[model samples]
Target: MSVDVTWLGHSTVTVDVRDTTGDTGGDPAGRLRIVTDPVLRAGLAHLRRRPRTPDPSASAGCDLALVSHLHHDHLDLPSLRRLRPAVLVTPPGASDWVRWRLRLPATRVLEVAVGGTAELELAGGAVRVSALPAHHAGHRTGSGLSRAPRDARAVEHLVRVPGAFPARAETDLLLWAVGDTGEFEASDAVLDAAGRAPDVALVPVGGWGHTLGPHHLDPRQAAELVARVRPVHSVPVHWGTLHPVALSRTMGDRFVDPGPRFVEHARRLGVPGAVHLPVGGRLTLDGTGQGTR
Candidate 1:
């Protein structure tokens, strides 16, 4: 199969990355739009979502929706509910949570633990979604998707716990992909057991604050990830968008320049073709070559 991809900022992507042959046309023999962790709302606890926009209708009918982990930004219930996916691919036990919140039927949300995948048939054809890695956490505030006006001071809610240690940072536990981690694929064991690298991976390389944690892969690090996974083609996401509230713009370049950085890395790694598309731009790519319109 061949595929086309569009980067919709952050971890959210419109992946028509199906197995159909190349350039199958806009509709393609297979143009299944995969909404990976869509943070559709304006503000998360502290970060302001980017200005990037996709055809709202484009997300209307989807073959499958993939929630890589439970991070609030990644597994946003409000965003997921709007998409109205006929099928949802998520981590191990999180389905119960999504189901509880969205009131979606048990069959609608196909729950797969980390290192597992689910196959679904779409209009164009079939696509496989594998639960990969993400360096963030998740939660649904009692008051669903906030309705209050913006706090003139910051973009998201800030919690302060001066010296208390954070959970998920302790190596002793294998909690969901929440909390801080090094800027490495700290979970190689999961990657290896899958037996094959992801053809298209949606990874997190940014955070909700001025500082970046180790577990997150910044754009440059993302490029390194590309060098390792070496998918035939890739889309650099989780960057150049979304900023924390009350925080000054000082944490700029790390989030702003990751896209181009990935491109540079791809070149240095001899990754022949790593295409980074515009916010809503459409692309048809393959190992055959690269072109932009």
Candidate 2:
């Protein structure tokens, strides 16, 4: 089996799973495509795309999309509209916000809590996605305190209700996309939930501002995270991609340095499989669990 990951920019990535074993007798080209935290527009919110990165629209046509949180950049409505993934996964209590924001009447939204799993079967293979604990706040603008009573009540009830997930099923690929979070102490909880370290970890190493915010991981923290979880291969996301256009002239290297810095830090921390994927770059994992750029 092999999984291919394309880092579009920032937290957006396209993960394609293929059955390379030859035993499944599936279409060699048939793969389940999943995009995480997709932001498929040139400019989103206050930040503008960095020059020279691939077009953000390259993330379109995903089999599914996972929104880790409600942050503007992560759950971009315009971007989501472009992809129109068949299934959309969000954290608990977020369906109302997503629906209201996107007006996605036909799209199916799956509300998953920490440890919940959602499985999707596609043409050539199947994928199992687990919602692990992210050490971050879940608030989004125009949500919660700002929503009217009806919507607020719905969100509260959905959040309080327990998450329902399927029994852990066998899958061709298993990925843990740690959306946007700092290092956490509840790693055991994550392991217990997934039952194993992810085959590949798409971790956030930087953000739009000069200073990292609460619950966001900088390059060093991202390296430490890889050391702890020890995925077969880890790729840095949420860095060297989007930045405030006005600051680009003044802060030349700041927007494009974290990914390389993270590669060095992961090596220093003894994470044997840290891979730095530049914008539009791709990484592939093979049957023996080795990764190639």
Model 1 alpha-carbon miss at residue 175, Å: 24
lDDT of each structure?
0.53, 0.68
Candidate 2: tens digits of C-alpha lDDT, residues 182-269? 6668643545655566567787888887778787888898888778877767888988777775776765676678888888999998
Superposed Cα deviation of residue 109, candidate 2 (Å) = 1.1
Where is model 2 poorest over a 10-residue stretch in terms of lDDT?
A: 154-163
Q: What shift in Å separates residue 21 of candidate 2 from its native position after superposition? A: 8.5
Stretches > 4 Å off in candidate 2: 19-29, 52-57, 105-107, 122-125, 142-172
Worst 10 residues of 1 by lDDT: 152-161
Per-residue alpha-carbon lDDT of candidate 1 for residues 232-286, written as tens digits (9 for 90 to 100): 4556666666777755466666555666777787899887456665556556644
Q: State model 2's lDDT.
A: 0.68
Error of 2 at 199 (Å): 1.3
